[model samples]
Target: MGAVINQFVINISLIFLFMSLTFYVMRTVLPIQRTSPLFVRFWFGVSNGLTAILLTINAIELGEARIDLRLIPIALSATYAGPFGAIVTLGLIFIGRMTIHGMSAPFVDAILMFIVFFLFSLVVSRVLINRVKGYAVYIGFGALLVLIQVTGSVGTGVFFNVFVPYFLMLSLGAWLCYWAAKKLETHLWMFLLHTHRATIDELTGLPNRYRTLEQMNDLEMSGKPWTLLVIDVDHFKQLNDTYGHLAGDAALRHIGQTLERNCPPSGFVGRYGGEEFLLVIEGSEDAKEVAEELVQTVRHTMFECQGEVIPMTISIGAAVAGHESSMVVFERADEALYVAKRSGRDQVRFA
Candidate 1:
């Protein structure tokens, strides 16, 4: 009885340790959904397969029975990775069993048992069920299979002494795995959400000013043609003074959306600051045509708020990024913007 409890605790501990390692990898190393599928398979399939083999090697003996917790890892693999994972784990487990017991009736029995479990797991993988149902169906089935394997095979004394306690521990171990997986999933989601919020502008729904600067620095070494357009809202202060700040916000959002829709596929637009936007395009054709197109689009777009119409226009300064640093290009564009504003807003100028 004591041996049974000790082995059950050890098996459950090994599984918990593996789950902790997986959680660490997902949180610090891999980007879950963004990670490559092949690498994902290695982590979810091959690693778990090895763990299953390890569990088999640690099988404990009680009277006429030898037992291990290999099925728990197999079920977990199927839950995360589907059919491919199930097959990998079961194959490794069969090899482990063969090495331990040699050619015998138990080896044949293991083969038959694996085939049935593999087919059942395949069905579980294809079903459109939630995580809870998937875990319940697969893990519950594994537990029942383990119970039946020990039923008549063990002596009456071993049955009462070893099997009952191990079964209870197995139930707890399965619940622990489910709980930990759910927690890691929630942490990954929150991490992604926090990252998105940090880099995105809430008001304009575009990349923020800081992200634009980062892109500019990267583009300097990209060896591709680059154009930077500095844009400022014309008479924005006057509009805010006449109507209200709320209308000014609405006007900015309208202009941002219009700029995004009209932007070329290769161009990226972002909020430069209050009443200002920057467009980075991949071309050396002076950026005049694109700038003019944007100017005309915003001019024609009418922004309405609370049944009130607000007139809006923008002045743009375009600069071709030559063999110059990002700072120099920005300075040239800012100077050109001054030129456009000084010569009367709502026009485009080149640096």
Candidate 2:
């Protein structure tokens, strides 16, 4: 049994090396989807080595596998790097165990563990992170533990011996690790929520004053060339007086949706205040093109309140912020908006 254990450990080590090499090569050569090449390169270099490190630590624990903490890397990989990250990590772990242990109990154990972490990456990360809460993650962890036990029982002794004591130990350890991660994720999410709410308008779901400030600050710090468009709904006060506050609100919501849909991918559109909205267009000089597109989108969008169509038009003032402070840039656009309003309401003006 002692000799068998030693042989298994050696096999596990060799398998880890092979897994790491495979990940590295794939990362280097394959075209990873949606992620930056730099990020792909970084993940490739780190994931396998990290997995090996975790495996090495657990292997040293021998039969006493307190393996729940092993999920930290897998969870991070899946959460930050996405499904590809999870797949790479999962594949390496699976192949590593298969290579070293010759398709025995450890192989089955590895598969069960991989499945649990993979689900964590796939399901837990998507829901938990988006909800901006940690409670979901903790619940997810507890559920995963139960699932692991069931999977363990099913796969037991077909390839590996099923031991009640080991199962109990593994489950308990996993619970502890999961609980810690949940707490950490919850606090992190709370912080993100607070920040998002501060900067985003509730009704229109557009960035408010705070968010615009932040965007400007980011642009200033990065020294990136960009364009700002100040959009003011024409005759908004008159429209409000004629139609009612509720109708006006509905119209505003319609405008927000239209702007969001039509805006460039990198652009940020938000309710600046009242009937005023702002768009920060990145990496584009053709303000005329963007403003024209926005005008068309607004013209085409229909706003219905109480089964009646509320016709609306926007006066757009665009200014390029090239090596200028955000305040200065906004001032330029504001002056342009004033010009647009004075000349005619439903036209684009640039400064």
Candidate 3:
């Protein structure tokens, strides 16, 4: 009995180690924003399959029965990755059990136990996913052990002396695995939020200068035909001085929204700094025409702040990417912007 209990302890430890490795890979290696349905299914399938294989190798033998932490993977996968992942995990465990036990009565009993657990997983997956740290999870684990014992051909004494210890170990193991996964998930979310904050403008909710420059680097690497448009709000300081900073901020926000709304599918628009914006449009034959449309849109649209209507105009400079670098093109666009401002603002100039 002591040996059996020790074996169960070993099984639990192994299960915890394997589960930690699985989550570490998920947290660090997988690409963010690319966890498609197929990818989730495949990832959970493989990870749970490995868990089952490990459990089979380290299974504790008690007279005519075999026990392991196989249920942890199934339970975690079902609750965390949904029904599809659960089904794949179940299939893998069945295959692993068959490989270990062969075609015998013990194998048949194992199959029955797995079926019972699978049904229970399906019933409680949604609840567990939402709340896995409560008394409900403990109760569910107890019920699972009861069902497995009743379904198996083991005697009452064996159930108490052997299976009960395994049940306790697995219950603690499952809770620990779930807790670690939740922590990693929270950390991932916070990391993504911090990354987003770093690359986006606070006021306009548009990509900031750093993110725009990163996109420019990507465009440069692609080596495709693209146009850069440098836009400046005409007489922005005067507008701010006359209407106050609040009105100026409102105007900038209005312009940002308009540019975002009118931006082409193949174009990127970002807040470049105070009263300035940048645009990157790909494969546009008439870049000046698009810039003119933007100028007209801003010129005609009325901005209201404190119940006062304010009209605004923008000067734009356009430059197409040639053999010159993105920064060189940007400089040329800035030069053209100066030309547009000198030739009378509220117009577009090409370089």
Candidate 4:
């Protein structure tokens, strides 16, 4: 009896160890968000398939019956990957059981258990989006054990000896898997937030200079025709001298908001630096028209700061990309911007 209990404990430990290793591989090796849907399905199929096979091979023996924590993988696959994944996992388990146990009473019992588990999983998947719904796996698996006992698949003595211990193991395993998955989710969200912060300007909520350059590089690599518009606020330093830096900041924020809101869908806008903004328009034949529109918008808009009405205008330089690199194109746009400022500020110049 002691040896039987010890074997059960060992089997439970091995099952959880396999589960933990699967999660570790998923966290470290798999690109969870970037993977294709077909690839995701294949991943869940292979991982949970192996888990089912492991459970079958290491099943605890009790008077001509075998018991394993196979439900853990099935429940998790369903909860995390949804119905399609649950179906795949169930099919894998069925194949594993048939290959190992052959056509017999034990095999039939396994099929019955799989059917019950699959249905329960379907119900659980709907609510699994809420973390608290995870406990349903325990109840579902517990009901599976009761079904097995009521159906007389196991003798009365073995049912009493095994049911409680197996249920306890399943409950613990389910909770651990849930905890690990939640932790991984939290870590992924934090990573995304940090990446966003690094690439976005906090004050204006626009893409920062670094992100703009990255986009420019990507656009250049695409080998498509595009345009860059460099805009500078006219008399910005003089305005700062008159109204103070806080008013200058308000002016910058207002300009960023106007450019972002009015820019065409094909265009990207960013705060290039102090009082300067960059706009990228893809596949544009109307670069001059867009530039003129932007200049007019800035010229007409009034910026309010601490009961002072500040009137502002912007000078824009437009350049089209052909055989030149992004940096060269940007430099040409900057030169056109200088020309606009020289020709008199409130207008657009093309290079």
Candidate 5:
């Protein structure tokens, strides 16, 4: 019992190690986001399948009972990745069991037990709604698994010793491994959420001033031709004074969304500062055209709040990149923007 318990603990640790290592590799090394859902599920299924194979290889033979926490991976796979993932794991476990106990009664019994478990799991999956409920169901599953294994194996003398320890350890191991994995996943996603928020404006859903400047600098340092358009809201202070600050914020949001939607495929639009926006177009010579288009777009669009629709306009300043730095280019655009505002509102000026 002592040796069997120790080996089972080792298997449990392996599950955690696999989960952590795989997550690190996918996050840092691969960095995949825009992939098909089916592809992601397939990849997950393969990983779980391999994990079950490893578990089967490390099985502990207590008399006739070949006790291993193989089903734990199947349960977790089903829990997280769904039925396809569990089926893959079960397939791998079948191959593993066949490899170990060829042409034997143990193999036959194990298959029958797995078939029963799989059917029962389908019912469990349908009945349970979330991981919390699923975990509670898992205790029952683990008990049944232990009973099946003990009934088939373990001559009368060692049945009690094997069943109790096996059930307890399997439950503990599965739960601890699952809890640790979820904890790590939560912290990882939370960190990513915070990091994403750092680069985004909460009000407009646009890149913040800091992120915009960073990107502008990167494009400038590349030593390639780019266009920068600086846009200012016409009479924004007047609008803020006429309406409340919340309405002013809503107007900004409306303007940001409009610019984002009309931005060219090769361009990026972001909130440059209060009442101002920046459009950075790389490898294009049509800054004036884009600026005029944006001006027209804003003039025609209406900002509606609290059943009131207000006409909005913008002044744009366009500057083509030269040998100068990003700050110099931005300053030039800013000056041109002032010229547009001075000349007339809703105008595009080139620098």
Candidate 6:
């Protein structure tokens, strides 16, 4: 009866440890959602489960001796999620250790390990690591880990050979994981940059018509209402004729920058076509405030070249989204812009 009770308690402990380790591994491997595809998510889940199984086997081999497997998870979380994720991973590990072994020397050791990983990884993510400047981070992390373990050994009076070898092994593993993560992160960043550039206008740095339409579709799908404002620069041809095409280009660039800076937080600006810009505004009932702001900003802008302050004013037209089709919205704004131009230049008119 005594032997059966001991076996039952040991089995229960092992199960709990295995489950905690499994959680750690899964969180590390799971996709961050922004960058991960469905297949990649599935594969990460599977790989983490397998790793948990291996860790469990190793624990059994060691006669259920307490080992700090926390660092493996922390290292992974640091590499992917950066400092915050590393801290969360560390907390999970600390909680896991306390549950598995209670408060003792080993638990203290585990807490120290978490702290070291959290601080070092925060440094790596913030200052030392990038695609080109990343090798230094790996070296720094490895050195930091070595210093921590050496200090820990000194304090604990543990067998030097055993602790030193294990520390070195873990450091090597951390280096490998960080290197892999850095490579992945670099590729992901590049992918996002390329995607953004493809969907954005080169001159205005705003989303192109395609991207704007895509966003509208997405918002519509998600049951959100939106409004569109189409703006046209009045007498753009006059500027080209008066100051030459170069000055006209300069004017466009200036206006693009200004509009980008001044648009509301829920607004998106786009370069729709030649001398024409589009804006998507959400939850804005009166486009008058926006229209007035643009009109004033454009009227006051002093374009300087060769110490000459060249002045220009723009006529703007605005339209809301739900009342019409995209084409109709643009046509209405264009009509309104014509009204502004006809009424007298340098004004905003809405339809």
Q: Which has the better TM-score: candidate 4, or candidate 5?
A: 5
Candidate 6 clash figure, as a count: 0
Which predicted model would earn the best lDDT? 1
- The CA-based lDDT of model 1 is what? 0.80
**Cα displacement (Å) at residue 296, model 5:** 1.4
Error of 6 at 47 (Å): 17
Q: Model 5: which residue pairs collide?
A: none
**TM-scores for all predictions:** 0.68, 0.59, 0.74, 0.65, 0.81, 0.61
RMSD score of candidate 1 (Å)? 5.9
Q: Give me the candidate number with maximum TM-score.
A: 5
Residue range 82-112, candidate 5, lDDT tens digits: 6666666677778877886786987887788
Q: Sort by TM-score, best first: what order?
A: 5, 3, 1, 4, 6, 2
Worst 10 residues of 3 by lDDT: 27-36
Candidate 2 regions exceeding 4 Å error are 1-53, 56-94, 98-172
Clashing pairs in 6: none
Question: Of 2 and 4, which scores higher on TM-score?
Answer: 4
What tens digits encode model 2's per-residue C-alpha lDDT throughout 1-351? 474345444534443444344433453333332253656735653564355545544543324332323344444345434656666766765665566666898568667766765665566545525421433353346446645566645555431432343334334443443454445445555666787789889888888978886887787778778889999998888878988888888888888889988888878888889999999887656668989888877877787778788788999988988777889989999999999999977888999
Q: Give the least accurate 10-residue stretch of model 4, judged by summed lDDT.
A: 27-36
Once model 5 is optimally superposed onto the true structure by TM-score, how far is the C-alpha of residue 33 displaced, in angstroms? 18
Candidate 6, which ten residues in sequence have the lowest lDDT sum? Answer: 60-69
TM-score, model 3 to reference: 0.74
Better of 4 and 6 by TM-score: 4
Tens-place lDDT per residue, model 6, 1-351, is 364334434433443444344434444343342135544433333433334333433442122232323344344444445556555545555555566667998568657755776677656766644432444453456456656666744544353434544455455544554455545545565666788788998876778878876765655555556666667776788878988888888778887887888888888888877888877777657567887887788778777855688776777877665644567666787788788889997887778
Question: Please, what are the lDDT tens digits per residue for candidate 1 over residues 60-94?
Answer: 66656666777777777777767677787788877
C-alpha-based local distance difference test score of model 2: 0.65
For every candidate structure, what is the RMSD over all alpha carbons to the true structure, in angstroms?
5.9, 10.5, 5.2, 7.1, 4.3, 9.9
lDDT of 4 at 279: 98
